[model samples]
Target: MSLSRQTTSRRRFLQGTAAAGAAAFVAPAANRAFALQSPNERPVFATIGLRNQGWGITNKSFKFADFAALADVDSNVLGANVEKAAAKQKKKPDAYKDYREILDRKDIDAVMIATPDHWHTKISVEAMYAGKDVYCEKPLTLTIAEGKLIEKVVKETGRVFQVGTMQRTESGQRFLQAIALVKAGRIGTVKKVTCGIGGMVASPVIPVAEVPKEIDWDFWLGPAPKVDYRALPEMRQGYGGGVPLYSNCHYSFRNWHEYSGGKLTDWGAHHVDIACWALGASDTGPSKITPLEYSLPVEYKDGNPVVHDQYNTATSFKIRVDMPNDVEMIINSAGDNGILFEGTEGRFFVNRGKIVGAPVEALKENPLPEGAIEEVYGGPVSENHTANFIDAMKSRKQPISDVWSHNRMLEICHLSNIAMRLDRELKWDPAKREIVGDDQANSFLSREDRKGYEINM
Candidate 1:
C-alpha cells in the first residue's frame, strides 16, 4: 500500500475501540507495520505541568494522538487547561495535583514533562519506572548529578526519552541547512563555536503573600528550599512570565540558583545541545572550562536589592571551553539568544529563525556533506517535536535528543555555572564525572535532597 494510505488506515484503527490492543500488538514492529496500520493508530500521551511551555507542547501532541490527561500543581492553570483540552479532544481529561496519580494509569503510554528544572529528574525517572516514555523539557536536570541519574534510569528502564530542546526539530531551511553544512564540513575544521544568550534580569523581589487558593504552594516548591511566596506583580517579558513564582517558576527561574542554573542552563539547554550535536560531541563534552570574566545581577530580597543577590549568577560573562582535538568553544553573554560556528572554511551563525554567514553568501552555495547531518538525525524530518517522542515510544528507539547525549551537553552548562561561582578555571574528568583538584567546586555538582526527596540510585 502507498504511505498515505497506510497512514490513513492507522489513524482509523487508532480511533476505534480496539486501538490499544492493536497498538500493543503492532508497536513492537512499528517501522515494518508503518505501511499497514492506519495513521490514526497514534499513541496516547499525558501532560504534566500545564503552565507556560507545557501548553504549547500539548497542542503539538494532539495532532498526533489523544491527550489522555493534564496534571499540574496550580488549579488555576490546571482547570483552564482541562477545559481547553476538553474542547479540543471533545472529552474532559483526568486532572490531578500529584503527578503520581497520572503515572499510575496504564492508559497513559507516555508523558510530556515541562515541570520546573528541579522536578524534571524526579518526575521523569518515576515515569520511566512506571513503564511510561517521557518527553521532558530542556536543561534536563537541576544539577550535573541529576542528569547522570536520569541517564541511568533511562538506560535501565529502556524507556524512550526526548529532551524538549525543540531547536533540533525546527524547520527553518536556513538554520537547518546551516547545521547540515557544518556537519558536512562545508565550514571546514570547527575551531570555535560561540553561543549568545541573555535577556532582561530578574525582577525586583516583592513580599510573600497568601498563596493563591487556586495554587498549591508546597507542591509547586517541590524539593526546593522553602521560601516565602513572593507576590510580585507579573511582568510582561514575552516567553512565560518574566519571573517564576518564588522567583523560580516563570522565565526568571533562569536567574535563581535553587531551581535553575540561570541562563547557563536555561538557554544552554537549547543552544549548547545543538552545538554539541553539530560538533558530534553529544556523548562527550568540553575537557576544560574557564570563566574569562563575569558580572552578576543585583540580588533582591523582600522587594529590596540585597548584597546576597548582587551576583547570584553571572549576568554578563564569557567562558572558553576546550573540546577534544584542540577545538575551543567560546560562549558569551551578548546579542540575542543564538549560536555562531566559526570554522576554517567560513563562519556560520544561527538563532531561532535566522542563519547568516561571515562571507554572507556561503550558506547559499555551500552544500552539506553527503548524508552527514541526516545520518545522525534519524527518523522523519517533519515530525513535530512532541510527535518524535510518541514515535520513539512506540519504536523504543532513541529520539533525536536522547538522555545520554543531553546529559553530556548539560555538563557543559553546569560546569560553566560552577566556574563562574568559583571565579576560577576548572579541570574536568568526563570519565570520572568529577571536577578535578577542587573539592568545593566538585561538591556543587550535586545537592543534598530534603529528606524523602533524595534521588536513590
Candidate 2:
C-alpha cells in the first residue's frame, strides 16, 4: 500500500474527473479520455459501507487514491472507519450514514461500494451516474435484470468499474495459470467443468428485535422488500463472530434469499466466475440448467418460499448446466469446494488458495511457458485488485474482471438457484437471455424491487 503525500487538492481532483466524464463514453477502454493525475498526485476516493470486505478494501484504497469521505448506514462502523482512515494519514474524511451523500460529492473520483448484495447494483449505478468510478464487491448484482441494468449503465457511462473478484490478481496467479492452461490446449478439448460451491444451511426461525441504535435499518434494507428487523451477532475483527443468531442483517444476509442467493452467490460469485472465464464462455451463458438433487429449508408456492422466518435457500443441492458449445458444467455440494476443470487430455481443480491436479503435478517436469500465464492475465500480474482498478483508471483500460463477462457468469449462478428453487430442469437461450417456453422460470430472471427502489436502464 502506497502512503499518501497529500499531493492533489480536492478542487483539482473534481475538475479532472468532471472533464473526463464529458468525453468518457465517446472513447474505448484502450483510449485515454481523461488526463489522469500522476501517482504522486492522488485521486480522491470515498468508500461506502465499512464492513469486513469494505473495511479491508478501504485500507488498501489509500495506496492508490485519497479518502475524501466514508459512508455507511451503520454509524458505529462509520465512525470506526473514519478513525482508522485518519490514523493511517492526516486526511480527515467526512462521514455519513447515507452513501448517496458521498456519491454526490464531486471531489470523489471513485467509490468502493461494499454494501450487501441487494444494494450493490443500485449504489453502483448511482455512483456511475454521479460521474464517480466504482469498485463494487462481487455477486455484483442480485438478479439477472440488475446485471443487465448495470451492464447498460457501465457501457453508457464508461466508468472504471472493477468487481471484487480479486482472485484474478492473487499473488500466486493460480487461477490465471489454470485458465491459461485450459485455453492453451494443455488440457485437450474441454469435456466438463465441475464447480463445487456448497449450498446454504437452514437457520432456525429468528425472532424480530429492535433495530440497533447506531444503524439506519431502513437505508440498509434499501431495495430489499420490507422485513422485520432481527438482531444479529456482531462480527468482531480478529474473532470469528459476535453471536449465532440467524437473521438478515450484516454477514448473515448471504444466507437469505430476500437479500442474496445464499452461497450460490457467495462462493459461486468467485469460483463460477472463474469457471466461465476458463471455458471461454464469459460472453455467453448456459442453455440448460437441471437440478439433479436439492433440499430447501422451507416449502414454496408460486416460487416464493412459504416459510420466511427460517432460511429459505437450498440447504443441499446439485445442478447440471449445459453451456453453449456443448460444454457440461455442474454446480453442486458433492465435492470439495472448488472448481474442477476436466478436458480430454487432463483435469485440474482451482480455488482462491491453490490450483492442483494431475496436469499441474506434471508441470514439475514439463512446465507451461512463461508467456502462457501472463497472457491469461492480459499482461504482467498486478500488485493487487485495487491496484489494477487504479491503474485502469489511469490508463483508461478495462480491468481484468470487467463487468460484461462477470455478469454473464452471474447469469449461470442465478439460473442455478432458480432451478434449485423450482426443483426442475429448464432450457435457456443465451442469445435471447431468457428461459425458453417457460414464462414462470423466465420471470425468475428479475425480482420485484420495493416500490421506491426499482432499477431502470
Q: Which candidate is the best by lDDT?
A: 2
TM-score to true structure, per model: 0.86, 0.90
Q: Model 2, range 1-457, lDDT digits (tens) per residue?
A: 1112112454465455456564643443223322233553567788888888888888876766678899998887889889999988677899998777876665677889898899988888888877777899988988999888888888887778999988677546788888888987878999899989876668767778888788788878888988888754534344325423466788778878888888788888888888899888999888898988888888988778987777787788888889867889988876788889998998888876788888889889988887887777776567577777866775556798889898899888888888877767889899988999989998888888788876533
Model 2 TM-score (2 dp): 0.90
Q: What is the lDDT of candidate 1?
A: 0.73
lDDT at position 362, candidate 2: 85
lDDT of 2 at 116: 88
Q: List the residue pairs that clash in candidate 2.
A: none
